[model samples]
Target: MSQIQGWAAQQAGQPLVRSSFDLGPLGAEEVEVAVDYCGICHSDLSMIANEWGMSRFPFVPGHEVIGRVLALGEQAKGLRVGQRVGIGWTAGSCMHCRQCLSGHQNLCAELEATIGGHHGGFADKVRAHWAWTIPLPDGIDLPSAGPLLCGGITVLKPFLAYNIGPTARVGVVGIGGLGHMAVKFAKAWGCEVTAFTSTAAKADEARSFGAHHVVSSRDANAIQAIAGSLDLLLVTVNVSLDWGALLGTLAPRGRMHVVGAVLEPIPVPAFALIVTEREVSGSPTGSPVDIATLLDFATRHDVRPQVEMFPMDQVNAALKHLADGKARYRIVLEGAKG
Candidate 1:
């Protein structure tokens, strides 16, 4: 029957349960990954609840995946059997598109998300296009490397896309899954990092993640205290905040780059941007080459996501922990190892 086993949600807002799918032969460019460790991202919660209105029934929700190559399609390129690899949010793209031809496959109009139309890594095996299946480097920490596939790339893309310089001052809002990694990447990229959190208790932990300064994202005065300072402010929380105060922290010509999936519409005061010539921008996770670059940079700088571990069979518990906002940073599901 070609049955593949995984955890799946029968409907929105339901807990996942054991399920199987009769997936046929792999595609020409496909590579199958045997799940070893998969990170639980906030987006997984959203999809499971249909927050983005794109959830599919009987869905397997996972994207920040670390695994080993189990099989390859006839035309899959650049990888061999039994190789260790990772897959992020994207699983495939139409290679003939302009975005793909230009090395921006992540921006492809027909992008296929790992957990969107496709079953993802919360399972015995998952499949993705050869390009999106990234190669992990030597000396990389396998256990903690899963979140880097998604959250790591989400925060790292801004620096490369916008050319954020080493001397630039960077501020990261919300010191959780995405923000912590942003702090580390900013520090390793030679930028001075400022970490902001609504929870004062996380201030010290944020500092430990490489922030030079820590502030309360909810404190208007604290936001003003660092006013006109940062060259780039990376917002990583999905929740709404004091947007105006945070916007004011940027230096003249500074940029506010958001990687979080904040659901509310952000009202930007035009004057706030006009006077200082500041800018606002956002990006999805990076392309194949960009992910490879992130992996290489992380290896050389010894940067990795801080993660809490859970057994794959205990995935429902892990998802609940993330939903209740109790995860210290990130959660990763451990599967059977080779």
Candidate 2:
């Protein structure tokens, strides 16, 4: 490929402009995909603004990618040209590392994020190691399915990791992008699901997403009403909240698992753990097998994200919509038109 056309920001907080760059020769283990659609995640905005201080100039940002395989290297196996596939937060990892060997490749020391140092799915085409270029299952909705690659896996990782069961009582704090998916996954898993949000307007919508209950995340009384009743509390909001009150809602031995990237340190009392054996933990997106499992589960359950769509060329407008918090649940960018 001579030049891969893409939308990129030349500097921090600038609107993405038409840009193209060469990846040169594709590696022996790589696969190139013709991007059809990509989801706009909040983290994408962070990367675009260099908020994490890791943004490289001419940065391309779109990790929740859905497209068809266009090219494959000689060593790329188990995938065919024209096969529909998806790529998430990770594009590649050191295949020889212990984490990769043990099927925990997301934790590999040198994980290559799609938009980190490399180009991402905001392009007409994107490339990843064959392993990270996941095949889309049959009968799945291709447009809205992009978020499943990134945010879906993010919320589902806790259920898979903690071995959450049907009998467990779960709480999802936040009802936007990630939390909504969490509610659906929890309800589909047959767990009793409670969704917490500060906004009263989202309550009914949360329940529509399969939440069994809705409560005020800002109300201390609301948090206390369910005190010690939850088996798992999944925090999906990046903003800080009543940490103690939220933690107090967990049952003995229950876990407070965080998927959101909260910037400040959360203060947890020592006795909070010692007395009830409560735990706090966090995880990024999942591994390849984990992603495949998420896709399969979503397919069987008819779980799909509610999304607003924009033509890929209107990326700046879409970005502003998301930045202004007008995106109802999530947003997807379609491939550029002919």
Candidate 3:
């Protein structure tokens, strides 16, 4: 076993503390990564707070990871020592499942998430299964690539899956970590991007992310202004919303793709969809292939997150910043030596 330093919650509702943990012997299909940076995602906060009720004690919670490959097992291939790499929410998936067999590993029932089912990148080093680790682009730095592992891919994959292109008039609801990325991706794709936020103060920030137009979602007049104008709506907020408000903004045969929180249970008016044949769906994280592609696209287009870096020891302050929406766009924890 290899000994390393990490910050983990000793118990539920407790703050993360520095501790020494063991990394078991590397498996034949595994590679050791020296974690350089890790994003402080909402999921990490949720898990540490035990919001989902499945968090393990002393949990090391961080899925958006970017690091250098320090070592490789005998069977690990296509990756070299000292190469920059990244790992997202998923670590393993049952190869026999239909989704996994079909190449949609994120949909596999037996998939293991980085922070939940396995030890994640909050530690100094993480042993990732080779098949799940992705190579990072040369143009992106480790800190910039950290959030791309999860937040970037989450927004980018749905656009690729739904075939959204130049002609699509896209609406991104919310302007936080996920919504901000949605704006950059949608604009880079040549879509007419409109950002919807309840708070008027976020309008300028939303526009800075590439949204051509920003509207106060709470204002009925503003909401009515865009009725039947959008071809696609990407709801990026976890809070409950009136589905009719969004469905009304869509043009005929429009689609709404959700990839936000797990606890959201919005009441959708069926008539909103039945009348115009609009569709509503959800997306999880992307497949390894999708992530690799997204990394290239992000670098090619300069689509990067505005992140605030914090030391791992300042995790509690970082969490508070994220919760208060004080961070510019994304929050990352550095100082973890993969």
Candidate 4:
């Protein structure tokens, strides 16, 4: 093994600094990718700040990665050298687990997160199990495709799990990174899309992103105006909101699903769900099969994330920009140029 260059935080809540470290050896089922572009996700901030208390120090935080295969282990399958591919939140999983055997590797009990205890794509090179390294389809733009690996799949999985159809009316809560993509997917899937946001400025932008309607998520009246109108409501914001009001917008038997990482308890009136038989649920990133399906759908619909670019060396600046809420949607880091 040789030293690989990357930016990392020495301690929790510390700014990222340029550093070099060894990658040890590639596992039998792993493949190495030469980093090209990596998306800056809010989850990266959580790990950098150790918000979840599961972060390891010297953290190299990036999971949404796009790169070309530089090498592959002897036992790695379905990938070749120089293949352009993407890796998401899960780097590896116990292949024999019930979930993995059923193609739900994301839910495996021993899932290995890219930055959980391992270095991630904020480096010159990164590695993942061959099963999780998905080959990019022909039509996806390389620069903007990174976020689809994580944020895109997070939203897409619910649609597949719930079997939402073309006639369903869908609502997306939030208009930033994840919510914006949800709008595009829902629209492309033939659903009438409504975007919920607190910012008046985003209302029009949400429509431009394929939302059929825009409502102020903070306005109780606006939320109530859409009562019993939606078949599915996707919550993508990390902050707490008026759950009661949001629930009211769903039709009887409609489902409210959470893909966001909201920290506090969401209080729901029992009668709100009990009377209508409405349901609430949450999911993590999707399995490899789901990622493949998402890529195919994105290519077919020409869906791409709105992104700002930063060079890998300027990762700290990029992180600050995302933290300041300055990014229009998603931020991506270009790898060190050869």
Candidate 5:
């Protein structure tokens, strides 16, 4: 109803500055959230830099949002005012579409992204369709749960989609954000977990995150040593790696899934797949139901992203920290303070 305050990048590659704008009346199916905390995702940086060539200026970038309902439209359902909730990438969808009807709203042809052509959660307030605003479970620690909305769901969807079992030997490539969560999830699922990373320093840290073993992603010898051992390998980095060597690590009938938004083409030798009957796949964030399941799983297993906190006003510095690759894992912005 009043002017909503936020930080925005007025131009590509520029620092976010304080900005205020009107958020028209709430839609019938929309609910407004008073943001409490918002996770700074790499996707947010990409959007700010116009990396995908789809960004709009005066962009407010945040999608992994943790907040309380401030107001609800008359038609909003299943959530109450003042309820804690988390909103991820998908904000709204054509609810009558086959994808939406089948409970895969993330795949709807007309899905609305939280930060696409709209304001996101890096603000004092934000809004989303009721379906995408999921109530936080009682047990989840709100501060750390923000990343679960995006990075968590991105990695967790592969496990659900591939029917990964407790007995599966899972390898997680990259020891940052999504990769870290993959390790935790695999171990908690009763799988033998292996972490692959280029940085030697992160190996021990990866082990602490539930990785039973760690291997150098760039070392042919180390990568070769684990040949044919993993039932599933989840790649979470956005850079191209030695695909052939990584493929060799998969057991017969194993799968390599990419959750990261790698800009480069992945070169996979046909023989690599033919010889081992291996497969490659990728997925976006999970459906709303899947997010809820992930939250429950995290709560039951006591899994959460390791995070550093910054006030929303210091978003530019936080962005720079992530850009410099200094974030231990993830960063979260405490919403506008009094």
Candidate 6:
């Protein structure tokens, strides 16, 4: 067993505290990683607030982890000690399940999430399954790559799943963390990108992120002007909006993918789908394969998250900053010297 210091919440709605915890002996297929950086995710804030009410107390909340391998178990394969690696939202999944067999590991029924079902990356060190650890490219630093493990891949995989050609017209909704990345990726792919945001202040910021057009989704006229104009709309907002209005912006056979959490239902009119034969889908964080592909693509294209760094001991302040939407984008926690 190994003891390491980390920030954990003793109860829901409480601030995370720096404490020590035991990392049990590694299994044959597991390895111990010395965590270098961890990204604070919006979902982490939700979990800490117990919004979903499934939070496990003494919870160390983080899924976007970048680290170096400290030790590897005997059965661990293809990884070496001191290698730069990362752990995403998934710790492991049932390999024999249909979803896993089909390469849809994210949807596997037996999936073990990094922070939810298992201990996550907010610690100074963690034990992870070998299959879930991905090698970080030498080009990307651990701190910047931390958000890529979650926010970066969450938006990237959905675009990858679409597999659209370079000529595709991509529209990204919302201008926050995920939406900004979506714009950059879409533009880099040689697509004409449009940004949809409710806030007028975000228009210039959206274009700066490579969006070709910035439209206010709040204006009825603005919404109608883009009606049936987009080949793909990536809805990245967590709050519910008029799904029909957004759907109306999709071109024929165009799809709208919802990647954020809406606490309440979005009123979806059945006719909206029936008319254009359009589709709506949702996506979660990526699998290990997806993460690897994203990292490579990001490295090749110089795509990185805008981040604000915080010390590990100030995790509570970090979470509060995230909850308050005060961080410009992502908040990363760096380890403190003992």
Q: Over the full model, what C-alpha lDDT does candidate 4 score relative to the true structure?
A: 0.93
Ranking by lDDT: 2, 4, 1, 5, 3, 6
TM-score of each: 0.98, 0.99, 0.96, 0.98, 0.98, 0.96
Predicted candidate 4 versus true structure: per-residue lDDT over 213-278, tens digit per residue: 999998999899899989899999999999989999999999999999998999888898999999
lDDT of 1: 0.93
Worst 10 residues of 1 by lDDT: 1-10
The residue-by-residue lDDT of candidate 2 on 83-134, one tens digit each, is 9899999999998999999999999999999999999988899999999999
Per-residue lDDT of candidate 6, residues 193-229 (tens digit): 9999998988998898899999887877888888897
TM-score result, candidate 3 = 0.96
**Preferred candidate (TM-score higher): 3 or 4:** 4
lDDT of model 5 at position 322: 96
- How many Å off is the CA of 308 in candidate 4? 0.5
Considering lDDT, which of the candidate structures 4 and 5 is the better prediction for this target? 4
- Where in model 6 is the C-alpha error above 4 Å? none
**Could you give candidate 5's per-residue lDDT for residues 199-285 as a string of tens digits?**
999999999999999999989999999999999999999998998889899999999998888888999899989987999999999
- Selected candidate, larger lDDT, 2 vs 4: 2
Q: Can you write out model 1's per-residue Cα lDDT over 1-338, one digit (the tens) per residue?
A: 24679899999999999898988988889999998999999999999999888998898999999999989989999999989899999999998899999999999999999999899899989999998889888888999999999999999999999999999999999898999999999999999999999999999998888999999888888888999999999999988998989999999999999999898999899999999999999999999999999998998999989999999999999999999999979999999772
**How much is the lDDT of residue 276 in candidate 3?**
89
Cα error, residue 51 of model 3, in Å, equals 0.7
Residue 264 miss distance in model 6 (angstroms)? 1.6
Residue 311 deviation, candidate 6, in Å?
1.4
lDDT measured at residue 236 in model 1 versus the true structure, 0 to 100: 96
Regarding lDDT, does 5 or 6 come out ahead? Answer: 5
What are the per-model C-alpha RMSD values against the true structure? Answer: 1.1, 1.0, 1.5, 1.0, 1.1, 1.5
User: Candidates' lDDT values, in order?
Assistant: 0.93, 0.94, 0.85, 0.93, 0.92, 0.84
